[model samples]
Target chain A: MSEFKQAEHKLLLIPGPIEFSDPVLLANATPGTAHTSPAFIPVFGESIKLLRKVLLSTEESGSQPILIAGSGTLGWDAVGVNLVERGDEVVVLNTGYFGDSFAECLEIYGAKVNQVKAEVGNIPTDDAIIQALASKPKIITITHVDTSTGVLSPAQHISSLVKKHSPETLIVLDAVCSVASEEIKFDEWGLDVIISATQKGLGVPPGLSVVLASKRAVEASENRKTPQQGYYISWKKWIPIMKNYEAGKPSYFATPPVQLIYALHTALESITAKPISERIDAHKAASKYVKDELTALGLDFVPKSRDIAANGMTAVRFPSGLKAPDVLPKLAERDIVVAAGLHKAIVTEYFRIGHMGVTAVDRQRGDLEKVINGIKEVLGKK
Target chain B: MSEFKQAEHKLLLIPGPIEFSDPVLLANATPGTAHTSPAFIPVFGESIKLLRKVLLSTEESGSQPILIAGSGTLGWDAVGVNLVERGDEVVVLNTGYFGDSFAECLEIYGAKVNQVKAEVGNIPTDDAIIQALASKPKIITITHVDTSTGVLSPAQHISSLVKKHSPETLIVLDAVCSVASEEIKFDEWGLDVIISATQKGLGVPPGLSVVLASKRAVEASENRKTPQQGYYISWKKWIPIMKNYEAGKPSYFATPPVQLIYALHTALESITAKPISERIDAHKAASKYVKDELTALGLDFVPKSRDIAANGMTAVRFPSGLKAPDVLPKLAERDIVVAAGLHKAIVTEYFRIGHMGVTAVDRQRGDLEKVINGIKEVLGKK
Candidate 1:
């Protein structure tokens, strides 16, 4: 019924599980590997190697850098549960929705959450951060691209500010949406931990979240006092497992998401071989074009400024009388997919255009045009 | 050069992430529905609907079940931490190794584990449990099949035994390996909980652990007074999330592993549509062929009794001097993969022949022949 003829039509334009290529899907179909297989260590190592490269994490910590399973939200729990003790003060920059969620999750783990406020388009300025730094936060957390509101805070500026004012406060960045879509210079940004998932940008299916810890973060993890975070998500137990198991010893964790790892392996090869800059540019081009087309069709963007809008997502606010909820299904009938807004801030008024993954690059022009035309046909442009 | 053709071969023969079909892989490639989409609730509904059929749970209790992400081991902790409060006395039947490991995980949550010991090839006699239940224990847990020994316990007999003697004592069965391969009658057996994974007989990749619960188990979960188990592995949160999200209100604890659900939806459909008895026959026949070919090559099965051996895995033990580790590489060289032993009781003496998925069904004759010939070629047998 659709132009996608691979027996897998259902183009996913919503952020993740983006239309994966057949080769990547084939890779995902590869058999499960014994965690202790001597041969599997390199595959795990190579995947981690590429993960680090894609995230631009060049730091050499004493142990393995990444943990394979669990979600992006749990990365905050992992960091909070492992790095922060009962009374530690944690600073969370709540530029948009996910930041507040991150703070609340940390608070549940018994850490005191200190929030710095900014709405969708606005970001925490250097002066605002300089004041928060005075309290001596144990670890500072920020979201580079708030997936909820399509806000892209300047990563370089935030990193520089943290390095200058709060030198001791280990900065952990939620780059779950940013990693594959935008440039993430982990080492350059001085981020102690960078969290990402396979779904976004990597063009693999969702299941695994890749967490990169700087040397300091791992050291902080060692000193964690609480009864260790549940074992499955525990990084402490897994690092030695990766080292010994990859080298053909007994595995610590049970069988990982094997097929998903294979898919991630194939997807990483595509991203790493080509410079990340090109991929980011592709996402930028796609997002910009979608914005342009939507603008011409008389829809407005939710973000206050184009410069601050997330490169991966173009959040559009529909006209006063027209609801995105009504228009979404009409497009779905034609096999065109887009994301609806998540929270109270923008649900009925907004819909999102995700410019991530291979399809966002390969078929962006036709897909964008179809979406634009589909919208106009449904609700005649004013 | 290695004989595994990266182009034509590397078919998955390992237990979980058991070889998936292209149709199912494309299912994952289907763009995602909004986690809260009206269509998605039914898709979620359809997934749970089919699980009830596959598990053969009580129709009334089947309507509300717990579906979670992450590894199968999480199921152990979920059952342990939730059902078990500190100082609760529980009896575990250790027919093979993983039952003891489940006991160990239960211990982490402060449940006192009194073990009822049984050998690998043997099932725990009713007397071992009868004596344990003499004092009215809190719960009785048993492994349905120990993948390590390629052996199963008489769960049907034991669950009924618990019901007759100690109806107050709850029954939990770790059906991780036996869920789809064997006829697991959750309702008839009166099991409080039945836990299994996506990989085994589910005809999909490994990433999910699907659990079916009884009303008593649900009631027990409600009265638990613990200050909540760790956040990441909380089944309490997931049970509600599944209902609320599927009922059209999406709550995010952690992002659902979207692709695994897609694979699961297709896999569960094939499982429920075909009668469980027919699926059991396929597994039994496939296992029989594997064992038959192994015997033709002059080998012995670790599980001496055919009645108790696992249909999914035929645990074959090599002769006195010939070790399993030596012959694994030979079969691996042929691009015909099999598993090495899981427990110390059989590690050096035995290797496993996994006949779990469609590959095991489709390529059984050729795959078994390759394994048989490879073993003969490696061991220099006639």
Candidate 2:
């Protein structure tokens, strides 16, 4: 790698802004390269191409990737403004905090939201989803892996249901926590939009809002009945910009985060170095190991079952009489940083551990072991 | 610093994404750090405090700084969605391309934008601005420095005019190309909002959108007649997040770009290390030197007069018979990168050279000399 090593830091076992590889960080430290420079255009273009391979979508499939400088939340804005016109009915398959927030975001743009909310540790029932579709909502949003509870929704199943019940309803999978760590067959699943960010399973630092839209999604956005409500997150403004960059030409609606794009290029390069299925398998192994170990330590989980849990991360409940302050600080003292619970219903009862990116794929890092052992030691002391 | 050296690359002399210091890039190479970790909270909090110093604003003045992950364009969204209600009258003091785009952004959020048009490479006249204010528009937006033509509008004068004629009108300064390189006395100038990004004069990479809002502006946003038109860019959603972080507590509406915040922390540390006035003077000196040398070489400028030209960048017209294609490629051959014109009316006649941050302040780098000499050689060859 060029003999460059990042400075020592805490082990970030949080769901996102996960442990990035040295090559990725080195790319992030790239010198000031113009966004439109020959050196950067290919990086931007290649990132777009690699995102398709990661999502299992393709250019021939008429899928477009819109990459912008913002968090995953901005993807919600993209959907609200571009896909949903004022007062259009939108179904939000709510699993956790993200689902609640996504529904709120859509409503902010004047969507009449129909929420299908699940219990604290469960996915929404298929019947509930079908009932929501009865209204023929213009869009249905599914949080593929909600970060708050580590719950994995049945995206493919949901997409199939949307197709069978309401073929016109766009299927938007909020894959912010799922993309690289989970197996997503975009075209095969008949998915319309998969909204994501770089910091999670993609293994780059945050600052990029990545949304992959199918042909139908693009058409829906373009043929919106009303003028776009927002300016920055408007797909109309970004479509040409993405098209131009993918064509190896430099164009600007707003300036791209050039350094982050470099980091993403390096990250996507490593991520797609081999078959993506292998990476997904690695995450599965890591997740199982962490969850199994935590279960043995007498901790419960936020997800109702193993099958419903995300492979990229796990949300675990503390033992009896234990809360966030009781466990999180102890782990921090051991140089491991994880996130506290975010679901308001069970906010104080659980915590999250992320096993994506290098943590899952690069076993030599010993990140999972350190976290597991740290938790075990903390529990023993308790 | 820390024995970390960035890889050698081409000299980027464009208006922004300017050459950053080694320290800033090294901070960008930081390993995974959670956005809410103890280590990052202070870095974020300190960056917020330092932003006030750079802008000559005060917490006591009740001004709030909202930092989010996006380009400078996102700052426009923040203004449009938060402050302007549907049918609200807004005045745009048009200077160049950025002014036109900001007007477009405001209009997207339902503002009736009355743009006081200026000729190419010129600022709007006082009489035109006064006439526009006769409607007592809700907001008056000024582009402090239009990157497209290197034209710097008289922000203070416009603020004075607005204050005298329409005291209730909010003064918004689009200082994307001017923030760190130009002196902005937010409190003294009666500015309601100063929209900027990190790349240009802050000496950080592009990703973070930084906007400082006056108390009145925040009130106007909170007391909006209608619901906010956006979700992600909504000031209502971000104000508490900023306040919580500034108060040394972690709160999240959206995930912040962690590594970029680290880079910004380091960049701001350096920018505020000395009196901000010195940094502004350095940019002015560099701009003058480049302008003097270009004038000596018989080159004309895009801005009508030297007084109204931007201190962070120079837009120079090619000598007659020589266009961007004739001179820019030759400079590129010497590994010096400059930007082609962005203002559509004069897009083919001129190109821009940036001399901000390290290029302007760190004389030992000889970056400006390299670019000036490269241009001179290209002209000599022609």
Candidate 3:
């Protein structure tokens, strides 16, 4: 097949469902292929294997990747249902709205959650996390990049600290906004689980919830005293099916989204073709360029420290006396779409722009330049 | 815009992930749009409105439509979490594998389940159903068309019986393989819930799970004394978001699959533009044509009675001494894809063919003809 061209439309500068490459979108438009069709089976199998390469997990590490037909929030349910029994204790390292929601999701499965809450645009410190570990929680969840405030927590550092303090605790990372763009050394960091979505860093349309679990996490689930309560989200039912698929044999627990899987296969192929370090560097450079331009216009960031900010997206507080109506429309008028603030306390006080995937990595697209120009024009920066 | 054209490939005759129309496929290839963009809000709102027309749910009936980014199985979880609280009794009419799985899902949510298992390709008799209902179960789950065995349950007749004997019992229909091809009147039948997927009769690639619930179902969910235990599948979290989107306001609990929703909008518009009754009739005629051809080749169907078989798909036993390996590759050689058997008891004894969507409704495409020719050629019946 030759290169496929995508239809032209407005640039999506929002956090997720970002601009996809022509090949990825074309893959999504494939004619319906049976989930078990030979042509489609390997597409799914290869996709699963490629997920490991993206996360830097080796086959020998016994890290299993799960791709299910749901949004990013479903990943939380998968973690909650598979790992947490009634009254099990879990520690949540809060960064923003997603951290609060993740804790609430775990609570639904009857988990007793103890959150080390961070201020807006910040993450819990290592000291606080270590102190929480003293309480002896079963799992510790940290949001790698909180979409609400664009805060990038130190997942590697936190995972190391958890290992040092509590050897038995499972380290879970919410990487919905960080997977393909961020530098995640799954094995090197001693992380147990990473929950993500297709729309954000993977550069595909939203639908599939991606989860990667280490051998220890799977063992914990297998040894649980109680039966997992969720039929769809349970790892007990899915792990074997995932294993069978990766082995090039078809197994069915549920019907997968065949077209979306094809898209994911193509996206993973593109993502893993180059060194992951290059992708991370590209995202970092693009983020710096955009942040530097915003700063030149005298804008302030939600994250107080530049080191704590995410490389994939930016959350900037609107100038005093300016809100969404005044700023968002001006950008819309310029044919760029940005997101409204999601932090509960400052819902109307700021806005967000995403610069991941093709918009960030494919510099020739000039997406960030257009977004920067639109923001400058809207704010009368000239 | 002029009519969109899809790429040519093999005819997909599997039970789902069926052939899609040009408009629907084009919609799926849409450039990334923000989930909350003004342009997208109307698309989502109109999609919800069109779903009502497809289900024959009148506005006065207060039937609420929910479109979530997940597979059809998620619908079962939605019903279990939202309405069937712990210790609640639910009766399942088991026509095939899906009914067994649905019962298991309800059980996962702590529902006490009683199943009336039908013989393969058959449904429970009225007397048996009445006897089961005598226990006054809180809910009755029925698979409208069991994809495993292609058995079509008498939903209207069963709904009428439930209304006469147990007026308060909620009736949920699993219409994953039946929706557009089968005739269903949600209001007239008093169906509390109908669960479906985009890949089947809807003629779109799978990703989105489509559900419609009655006002009574909504009230049952709302009046629950205990908090819902699911975060992503909770109706409480989804209902308000659905309400806001339908009212042209953007609200999000989790990100919707924006491109898939756009595809659903196009498919619904196409389905609704023509009289729905006409679409059902077209599917019926196509089914008759395919079934007659199979019978001519001395093939027997899983469903003993023709009336009990689904119009959208067929499950036919392999001739004695012939199995999947013997038959599947022959059809594949002819560029046709069919599904392997799914019913545990008959996993290798039969195969399934889908005739819904463009394959059945748009006769000019000759999809069924190609499938018929391929099957005849494979069996050496020329």
Model 3 residue B381 distance off true place after TM-score fit, in angstroms: 1.7
Interface root mean square deviation of every model, in Å?
A: 4.0, 0.7, 1.2
Fraction of native contacts (fnat) of each candidate: 0.40, 0.91, 0.81
Q: Give candidate 2 regions above 4 Å deviation.
A: none
**Tens digits of per-residue lDDT for model 3, B1-382:** 5355666777899889898877777788788899999999999999999999999997688889999988898899998889988999899999999999999999988899999989998899999899889988999999999999999999999999999888899999999999999999999888999999899999899989999999999999999988887889888898889989999999989999999999999999999998999999999999999999999899999998999999999999999999999988889889999888989999999999999998888899888989899988888887
* lDDT (Cα, 0-100) at B361 in candidate 3: 85
Count of clashing pairs, candidate 2: 0
DockQ of 2: 0.90
The TM-scores that each candidate's chain B achieves against the reference are 0.91, 0.98, 0.98
The digit string of per-residue lDDT tens for model 1 on B181-233 reads 87688887888887777778777667776777777877787787765545555
TM-score-sorted candidate list, best first = 2, 3, 1
Query: Best candidate, lDDT-wise?
Result: 2
| Candidates in descending lDDT order | 2, 3, 1
In order, the first chain's TM-score in every candidate is: 0.92, 0.98, 0.99
lDDT of 2 by residue, A185-270 (tens): 99999999999999999999999999999999999989887898888988888889989999999998999999999999999999
Q: Candidate 2 chain B, which ten residues in sequence have the lowest lDDT sum? A: B373-382
User: What 10-residue stretch in candidate 2 chain A is worst by lDDT?
Assistant: A373-382
Q: Can you write out model 2's per-residue Cα lDDT over B5-67, one digit (the tens) per residue?
A: 889888999999899888899999889988888888999998999999999999999999999
lDDT per prediction? 0.73, 0.92, 0.91
